[model samples]
Target: MTDQSTPLAPRQRISPVSRVAEIVTSSPVVLIASIILLVVVLTALFAPWLVPHDPVRLTPSVRLKPPSETYWLGTDAYGRDLFSRILMGGRVSLVVGVAAAIFAVFFGLILGLFAGYIRWIDAVLMRMVDGLMAIPSILLAIAIVSLWGATIWTVLIAITIPEVPRVVRLVRSLVLSAREEPYVEAAIAAGSSTALIMRRHLVPNTIAPLIIQGTYICASAILTEAILSFLGAGINPSTPSWGNIMAEGRIYFQINPGIVLWPGLVVSVAILSINLLGDAVRDALDPRMAKRGIER
Candidate 1:
């Protein structure tokens, strides 16, 4: 007979691989999305070596040629290999999306920490964030790109600027709640420096939410870059980004729909996978959702 007051042994923490395996096995959608995203990312990363023909090489003889054994996907207006171009284009899209998300989160975390922890700067910082948020993100990005010129870096900056405000707001809200907790108050009373308290006490509370937010931001950034490229406000047309591919093919859609369809399909799948992964992460992280046994 066990003593009534005796505490049970603590459960061991699950390994990250085990946790991921559990998530994948429990959800078929998550499994499929994860596989597709993994394949796309790997294909993009290895594209330079994997491509059979030069993505930008112009073979006028093969221009507008339908899918063949030589050109697996087909040829575009300039006879660039659609398959090679797509693989290379994905690298650009992934780079921009990932870099933009990282920058946005990094800058937003710093600003939000300052704004939420220091009351003196809270109103001022929030006002600036509000001003940025007031403008439409797409319009703001276009304006920035137009002024700066259409380069990969310029497009990344354009996408990142609009996204920072949202992240700042999210972090600020998280900090606001966390700072009021008893542990935070105890830290404050213990003569800890503002920076120390923020780093030790506040930052951890924001990590889970930030991870979930980052996935959405990455997806949005990818879509936004594609839109910008399509509108001639993004990467140089010479560069074979997914957006440029679709934009070039739009005029020839009636003749060769595959050019546009292929890139568009890839973009849709990438974004959908990212979003679905984000949802899975959210469900896994949220204690309330876990307690409720929510499955999606």
Candidate 2:
């Protein structure tokens, strides 16, 4: 005596991507961070048009001038325009940060997927990651750069190495957990192959966390590049990097405080912008919070 009139499956829920967008739009912090990040990225991409002067030019006559009408944000010890250098330096920082994070993420994803998929290989790869992690990232980068010689490629490789392990750890764990789920079990029971399962199902689920990690890594990479430059291990002097500017300022810290103050200000703002973007992204990607539509 079954109810023959009605036999129905439950409705499919809203997709997470759509839900995430809706929730993100509701958040003012996310809105502001997104806007600021966009502005910063665009400024970096268009530095030549926006900046008022050549970043690396020297003018001993105008050296250490205070912020004024002609030389806005004043000039450095060599009289290069401070604002122009900051703008130009941002372009380099953005390129390094994004390029390193993306390279690390790509390398990690490939390694992580392999490790997560194959049992015996997982132990070996994770151990290697562990060995790399045991060393302080900054020290490891300096050692590699010293051996390879200081160049943009060397800097990119050095910055990316530490972050790869982090991404691998996150992705591998997520894949392992998802592999045991009921949907995965169902797929395994069906005619689907392992490659199909991983490609079709596993990678998509892990993307949310990967995005969050990428933002954090971008912040870390930028900070690391700045520190390396400060320590004389970064870009060539002619490049006019913020870190280089800071390094130059160190000598004039006592007499001309603007030297340190302006460079430090730009670095802080850049790092802060990245961190804020990360926070907003983390909130948006939080599965529990996203599902509930609760502001967390």
Candidate 3:
């Protein structure tokens, strides 16, 4: 006979704070990177209100002034407040990066969906993707910007086109494998339309990978924009961008290294933070990686 006084065990629950602490301890690098990214993003988003002076407003007498109570990061050769311009430039860099990534991912998703789902078009589209990939992306971007003229929109387009092929290949491969799954085949046997099968079965599988891809694309796009602008082929020089700021500072670098130093640091930190976040996300989303971690 069973003992009359046998007690049932209570279920243990993990609290949100404990879960957060576990994540932070398990991936301290990602936690630090996330904090850095958050601070940068917030500063850029509120730059207009947070800026001490107009980024573009100039004072001839104050040109090239060193850091002071009045001029925090000093004045550029153009006499604009270096601190304010840096803040504003962050806005431009982030905007271009995010916009280019979105354009690339959106077009890539559509083209990949069609190419992978429609067997007849796959060969032609994949070949086109291959040809694009063969060319050095920076050179291709330069050629496009040269023809289109160096405006903000053109820079965004140039950055996006080069990135699309990478996304297309990833999405296409995912769709190809996913479409052959037993569930997908069963859906086909049920007389489901191609659209329904792709929408319901394939697209959902692509989201996690696409999100990680998007972060990398954003980091690359930002770096590309800086390179193009430094080469005088990106957004107009009049605009306050990290690239433009660094480009201008090169001439007066010996006199005021701070000008180049500040903006360059901003770009470096932003890219690093983004890449770290992407790596962390990839580890979290990839089941194989999680399995390996557990095994270790």
Candidate 4:
């Protein structure tokens, strides 16, 4: 007989398929969001191939046609295929949103780390952030875009600037809490450089919050882009973006509601999916909630 104190054989490693299945089952919200995101991304990627008609190709004869077997989602005032325009529009909206979020988060992270870690400049940095926060983000974005001109890069830059302050505040808060941990103090006591302490210790603690914030930034960027486009201060009208689609269609909204309806639906779905997934991620990463989840 084996010794009673001896540990049992190592548990069998989970197969890759089983691991994937487990993740899907455990996080249904994430799975749903992932599917929606994948579809939107793929649609944007394959817009040219997926589109039944050239989105920009104007057909005078078909202008304002209602949803039908031929046009599917119908035609806009310029007689551009709504379906194709919707698919192609996603490319600009998603690209600008995702790009702006990435830039905002990156810039914010660096500034936040500096402000939180270096006591000398904390007050100054926080004051600057507060100043930016005091301004209405949308109004500020519109002003920037109006000054810069309605171009893709301008809109991206405009969107990124307003989002940076939010990210900076989030990262700074995390760094403040993490710096007081015993491990961090011990690292300092062991002659670790400030950079090393921040890189190895503080940075790791901010990941969960950063991920959650990034999703929020992404959703906010999308909405902001749409708002700017609607106001004629974002991307050029020639560029197919969801906001532009709705803006152009609103003129003939009474005659052809599908033009605005389809793009609006896509935007709503995308933002909702991201928010749901963000909540799920936040719940999963927070230790306080982990025990409650298991108990349930």
Candidate No. with top lDDT: 1
Residue range 1-296, candidate 4, lDDT tens digits: 97779777874544434543444457877688778988998999899899999999989999998889999998999889999999999999999878987899899999999998998788899999999999999999988888988899989998999899999999999999989999999999999998999899999888878878988899889999998988888899998999999999888888888878899999999998878767766766666665554455
Off by over 4 Å in 2: 1-28, 189-191, 294-296
**Model 1: per-residue Cα lDDT at residue 136:** 98
Candidate 4 residue spans exceeding 4 A from truth: 1-30, 293-296
lDDT, model 2, position 55: 81
Give the 10-residue window scoring lowest on summed lDDT in candidate 1. Answer: 287-296
- Model 3 C-alpha lDDT versus the unseen true structure: 0.90
Best by TM-score: 1
Query: Tens-digit lDDT track for model 1 on 1-296?
Result: 97779788885655434555677678999999999999999999999999999999999988998999999999999999999999999999999989988999999999999999999899899999999999999999999999999988899999999999999999999999999999999999999999899999999999888988999999999999999988878899999899999999999999999999999999999999999888888876776665454333
What do the candidate models score in CA lDDT, each in turn?
0.92, 0.83, 0.90, 0.87
Error of 2 at 293 (Å): 1.3
Can you give the TM-score per candidate against the true fold?
0.95, 0.89, 0.91, 0.91
10 residues in a row with least lDDT, candidate 3: 13-22
- What does the lDDT come to for candidate 4? 0.87
Global fold similarity of model 4 (TM-score): 0.91
Better of 2 and 4 by lDDT: 4
